[model samples]
Target: MSYTDDERIRAKRRALYILAQRDHSKKELYDKLIKNYPPDLCEMVVGLMCEHDLINEEKYTEKLYRAYINKGWGKSKIRFELRRKGLPDSLISQQEEEYDTEDFIDEIMHLVDKKYASKLDFSDYKSVQRVTAALARRGFAYDDIKLALSRIKDGDYDEYDE
Candidate 1:
């Protein structure tokens, strides 16, 4: 089967509509269009979109970073998501510098604090280990997790001694 001129136009328009809903990397847009159109035609459409400023890798990368940050994801998780989306490593590296490590750590700390607030009794080693694992899963490094855990443990100990 072959797409007519009208069908090709409609497919391109539909691809753009899908992209309009959210920022997509160029490879992603190309892959989506290729599902319905020929590879060459999809490449042309992607090129046209780029020329028209409809799809920009840099802008998409920045938007992705901010979106993940807003969702409280750490740099490591954000980097991985961006990579999975087919974003270039250089682009991700450039955008990574825009995020401060301390800020990411603070976000992790806030999440941990809120989650463990009620279960602060620290009844056993398992509790601390569980909380540490939770923070690690959030993309925090071991040192940061240990520091946050230490603070929580110290706070609990003081409360119990009194």
Candidate 2:
């Protein structure tokens, strides 16, 4: 489809406006611009942005990973989010490999503290169920959730310091 030069210019302007607000994956920017512009125009605009480093997939991926991590998200959840944003598996795996089990456990613990007010009493079956479900919903691994629950239940929160 042939897009008018005006459409192309509008697409570029819209892309920069959105990028000024936040970083976006190439696909994300295309999807947003294509809502009002032709697909071809959107693609061209995204290509231009990429060529100029205005739309860097790697930079966006890393920034997004760190943001999710700071928000107490587990790797599984963060991976799902990045995938949904149209990030390639290879890039996501690179960031995933950088973190260890301890980092994930620590994130889960921080989530528990923040969400449960650091007063999770796993002694109560209901409390255990609630916290466990919460962690699972956050996309944490089964083993990580299980270990975290056991530690919290045993009042061994200090063990996560390492």
**Tens digit of lDDT per residue, candidate 1, span 4-62?**
88977987797789788987888999888888887878887888888888889999999
> lDDT of each prediction vs. the true structure?
0.77, 0.83
Scored by Cα lDDT, where does model 2 land?
0.83
TM per prediction: 0.81, 0.87
Question: Model 2, which residues run further than 4 Å from truth?
Answer: 1-4, 117-119, 159-162
lDDT of 2 by residue, 31-108 (tens): 899889877778889999999999888878888999988977888899999999999899999898888877888777
Clashing pairs in 1: none
Worst 10 residues of 1 by lDDT: 153-162
In model 2, which range of ten residues has the least summed lDDT? 114-123
Q: In candidate 2, which residue pairs get closer than 3 Å at backbone N, Cα or C atoms, i.e. clash? A: none
